[model samples]
Target: MSLRVAYGARRLFVYLVALVTFGAASPALAKEFHVLAFGDSLTAGYGLPRGQGFAPQLEDALRRNGVRAHVTDAGVSGNTVGQGRARLKWTLDGLKKKPDLAIVALGGNDMLRGLPPAQTRADMDAILAEFKRREIPVLVAGMLAPPNLGPRFGAEFNSIFPDVARKYGAALYPFFLANVAGVRALNLPDGVHPNFQGIKRMVSGILPSVTQALNAVEA
Candidate 1:
């Protein structure tokens, strides 16, 4: 079977199981604003407990401010931009309904792995294109390469966000880890993933962009 067909099938299987599991709750969830958090360990809430992940925390923050959102955590730990591209289609296909907004917060792992910024740019471009094709609004929340990687690497990596966001005319959140990245108190023991406080800081930083994107979606 073609890769597309295989992925579509997997999505269908996922939809069936999700249907069974969230049967009664599905309709209510459907009524809420839907946003998809698509990225890496950060979005997946790597080290922190289940409820403290980026998606959940962000959703809570949004709702508190009266956004009434339901954010889906589609992040997979250790996933690169390439992996994100490969799964993009099926991830949307499996959504019970297409998200009103998709937060593209990837490229961190790519930086960590020293993957070419060109490759990251390409994958991000494709993902943004697909979102546009499906009429899904995108919110590009970018990650900066560690400064130790050198100014050249940081330049290329940091440019990926504005470049892609402008290319797609999507909303942009300059840094996904804005206030928490180097805050030792906000990070986990590994100093990579954020602790709850860090996640809160992240949510606070990203919330305005999210609110703006959501407003656009509603419009």
Candidate 2:
């Protein structure tokens, strides 16, 4: 072949190689991120259909927003912060792969039970410490106590989540059931948990925080 044609072909090959290399290094390159939604019945979907739970809905929302993530539901009904701490290791051990992000949605049951705020915080701290030790990014979802629980108890109980998140540098979703909490129509018959419509609203409110947590993991 002519030297001119040979040199031109070589240049083309080099350019293609460089392009491929850059593309591989680009952050925009899609990556599959695994997220574990760890919490109580709220995360588990409770009385709703299997597909209608918070994890499934959140996964759909994440995908819709172009995040390549699989959100695993690790919720157990009636799990308090203490119970969550106890089972955390087993839960993590059972995962096929370590999750890039974990969302802690506990404390609802703790609040309902009128558990001591200090004990609840301690349990949460332990949970957060474990995640931090494993270098797993966490997004803590806070739960508020009912007003009937009294202002002093409510304030102390409600502050546990944010305090822990602040201490551990985890992301905080100020209130997991923000838009759905007080709305009578959104709750189940028991009025303590969310119904289908309530779950949707909760998912929507938490999406931004979840997305932020995902970004932290990627970063």
Candidate 3:
């Protein structure tokens, strides 16, 4: 072959190699993790404007923390643990792909409705079991029962989340509403769902656990 042609071929091969190497190492080429924020109105960003809800805020936070993630809000307002378990399949089917990690944040509505804690625990177990069967990692966002519910009820209800999470070997974010639960300024007028800032607080409180879960998924 002519020297000119040989030199050109060598340069082309080197350029192609560089391109492949860059693609392998580039953040833009990294896997986009899928996270399902499956819960009730809290995850749905009830009373908050677009982009201010838990899912979007969490997604933005993850990106800021140098993680590429698409958080899907599978939350339904007023959804109980039983309802969430029942609709788990439908929600998963609607997703374009199976979630790499799922944040199960139900049972709040069940507590509010004065449902039996045993029932809540069972449904939560079912939900986590489904995710396990699909081989998806999970982070259980717990909910605390109000004092008005009485000590007996509170004891049973509050234990539901941690118990289920332990049983499934899932990561647990002890309380979803950690710092903003009853704060007047953080909550909406109804005092049930969080406002914009409240959602931010929730995302902040759970961000570390989420990052840990994402790391596990990548691993």
Q: Which parts of model 1 have CA positions greater than 4 angstroms off? A: 1-31
Compute each candidate's TM-score over C-alphas.
0.85, 0.88, 0.88
Model 2 compared with the native: what TM-score?
A: 0.88
* Alpha-carbon lDDT of model 1: 0.91
- Model 2 regions lying over 4 Å from their true place: 1-28
lDDT of 3 by residue, 55-104 (tens): 99999999998899999999999999999999999899888988999999
lDDT of 1 by residue, 100-158 (tens): 99999898899988999999999999999999999999999988888899999999989
Candidate 3 lDDT score at position 5: 100
RMSD of each: 15.4, 3.3, 3.7
- Evaluated at residue 76, the lDDT of candidate 2 is 97
RMSD of 3: 3.7
